[model samples]
Target: MKALISNKVFRIVAFADLLQQSAIWIRNISLLFYVMEQTNGDPVAVSLLNVLEYTPIFLFSFIGGAFADRWNPKRTMITGDLLSAISIGVILLFVLAGSWQAVFAATVVSAIVSQFSQPSSAVMFKRHVPGELLAPAISISQGIMSLFIIVGPVVGTLIYSTLGLVYSLAAMIGLFLAAVLVQLTLPPSPRPPERRAVPILEDVKAGFRYIRGKRNLIVIAITFACIGLGSGLIQPLDIFIVTERLQLHKESVQWFHALSGAGMLVGGAAAAFLGQKLNPRVVIFVGIAFLSCSIIVEALSVWVYLTAAMRFSVGVMTAFMQIVLGAIMMKLVEEAYIGRVNGAITPLLMAGTLAGTAMAGPLMKTFTLVPVYGMSATIILIAAFASLSMKLGGNAANTERSAVHLD
Candidate 1:
C-alpha cells in the first residue's frame, strides 16, 4: 500500500483522476438541479438530462478508445478537460443569456469530450501502478469517485438553490481547470500508434471481434451492461422515493443521500483493504450479490430509513464491484490494447445505462419503486448466474492472464 500511494507520479495522476471523477458528480448534480428547476421538477426531464450526459458512450466511446491508443494518455486527458471545460463554460454563459436548452446541449457536449478521455484515463492506471497493487488502488480510486458523486449532487443542489446556478457551475469549471493543470505535471506516457491505420469499419470490427471471442470478457461486459440498466434507475429513484413512496420530507431525502455518501466512503475503504487478500472475481460477485439484495430490500417499501439502509448497502456493493471489475479488466488486457478494450466495452455498458435509465423512468411513473428495485435485483442475479456458469462459480479467473482477445 505504501508503494501504491507513495510514488510521486502515481500520486499526482491519481489525485488528478480523483478530481476528474469529482467533476462528473459536480456536473451531474448541477445539471440535475438545473433541469429540475427548469421543468418544475419533472422526473422525466431529469431522466432526459441523464440520457444527455451518457449519450456519448453510444456515439463516440470506441473512437475515443482508439484515439487513446493513438495518443499519450496525459495529452488525451488534458484535451478532455479542455473540451469539457469549454462546453461547460459556454453553457454557463448560455444560462446567463436565458437559454436552458443551450446549457443542456453544452452538458451533452461535455459528456462527449469526457468519453474520449475515459479510455486513455482507464489505461493510464496500469501504466503508472505496479501489477500487484492495481486492485486495491483502483478500489480506492472508485471509492473516492463514488464519494464525490454522493457529495456533488447534494452539495451542488444546496449551492445552486442558495447561491444560484451560475455560481455553482462556475465552481465546477474551476475544478476542471485545476484538474487540467494537475494532469500537465504527470510523467509522459507514449504508446506507438499505427503509422498506417485501418479503415473505421475495420477498426470497429476488430474491437467487436475481440469481444465476441473472449468468453470471460463477454461475461463480465454483458453482466455490467445488465447491471447498468438496473442501476440506471437511480436517476429517478431519489426523486421517486422522496416524493411518491416514502412521502418523506425533502430534508429526509437529502439526509438519505448524505447517508449514502457516508456509506460509499466507508465501503470503498473496506474494499481497498480487503481486496488484496481476496480473489478479484469472488470479490466482484460478493459486491454484486450484496448490491442486488440491497435493491430487493429497497423494493419492499418498508420505510425511509430502511430504504436508506438499502442504498447504503448498495453503495458498498457498487464500489466493490466497480473496483474489482476494473482490476480484472486491467489484468485481462495487453498494455498495448487497454485503450481499445475500454472503448469496446464502454458502449455496451452505456447501452445498459441508457436502457436502465429509460426503463426506470417509465417504470417508476407507471408501476412504483418496488418494480424498479425488482428490476435492479433481477439484473444482478442474472450477472451472478452468468458468473457461476462461466465456471468462475463466482470466483473463476486465471491467475496468469493473457490478452485473450483472439479466437
Candidate 2:
C-alpha cells in the first residue's frame, strides 16, 4: 500500500477522490435529514430523493463515457469539479434565500456531472496505475472512501443540526473547490486517437456490442445489477429502521452509518492485504453470500445493537465485493474500452437501483420494513448463487500477467 501511494499521480488522484466523496456523502446525508424534517418523515419523499439522485446516471452515463474516451481525463476531471462547485454555489444562494426545493435540483445536477467525472476517474486509474498494483490501489482507494463514509455522516449531521443548511452548503462548496485544486496537480492524461468519423451513438452501440460479445463481462454486469437492486431497496429504508423500528431519534442515524463505515475500514484493509492472493470470483461470491445472510439477520432482529452489528457485517462484505469486482473488471477490459464498458454496465445497475427505490415506498407502506429487507436479502442470495457460474476467478492471475505484458 505504501509503495502504491508513493506514486505521485495515484496519491493526488486518491486524495482528490477522498475529498470529492466526502463532499458527496455530507451533502447527501444533510439533504436527506432536511427533507425528512420538512416532509415529516414521509417515505415517498425519501424514495423520490433516491430516484432524483440516481436518475442522471440512467440518462447520461453512456454519453459521459463516450466523451471521457474522447477527452483528456485530467481536463475532464477538473471541469467536473469546477461545474460541481458552481452548482453547489448556486444551491448555496438558494439555501440563503430559504428555498429548500433547490436542494433537489442541485442533487440532480451533481449526479449528471458525476456521470462524466466517474468515468474520467476510472480512466485515470487505468492510465496511471501499474497493472500489478491495481488491486491494492483500488483497495487503498476504497479504504479512504470507507473512512469518509464513517466520518461524513457524523460531520454532516452535526453541521446540519448545529450550523444549519446554509453553512452545510458552504462546506460542500469549499470541498468541491479543494477537489478541483487537487485535481490540477495531476499530470495531463492522453486523449484517445482520432478515428474515422463516426456518429457518437454508433460509438456507444459499438461499446455495447463489445460487451455483449464477452460472456464473462455480461455475467459480472448482471450480477452487479442484482446487487444494486438489493442495495437500493434497503438504502432508503435505513432511516426508517433507526427511527421507527429501533425507536431512535433521527440524529442517531449517523451511528448506524458510522458503524458500517468501521466495518468497511476493516474489510478494505483485509482486501488490500489479500487482494492479490484471493481468487476474485470466489471473493465476490463469498462476500455476496455473507452479505445476504447478514441482511436477513438484520431484517429479523429489532434490537438496535444487534442490527448495528449486522449492518457492520454488511459493510465489510460489501467492501470485499466492491474491491474485488472492480479489480476484476479493470483486468478484464482493455484500457481503451474501459470508459465505454463502464458506461454500458452503469445503466443496468442504475436501472435496478431506480426500480428498487421506486418500489421501496409502496412496499414499506403496504407491508413495512421486514418484507422490504427480506426481499433485498432474497435477491442478493440469488445473485450470490448465480455468481458461482462466472469465470472471473479462473485464470485471474494469468490474466493479470497477460495484462501487464500487454501494458
Q: Can you give the TM-score per candidate against the true fold?
A: 0.86, 0.87
**In angstroms, what RMSD does candidate 1 have relative to the true structure?**
3.4
Model 2, position 250: C-alpha lDDT score:
92
Q: For candidate 1, lDDT tens digit of each residue in 1-407? A: 78887866667767887777666666677777777878899977876776687776678888777667667888888988887777788888888898877767866787788667877776778788887788777777776776776666766667667877787778778878999999888888755544566665566667667766657778878787877776777655766667767786666776776777777777778777886677766766777778778776766665877887777777776776677777777876766667777888867766876677677767877886777778778887777766543334233345224335431
Candidate number of the best lDDT: 2
Tens-place lDDT digits, model 2, residues 302-381: 79889888878878888877888888788787776788888888678778876888788899899888988999999988
RMSD list, candidates in order: 3.4, 3.6
Candidate 2 colliding pairs: none
Task: Give the per-residue Cα lDDT of candidate 2 at 356.
Answer: 85
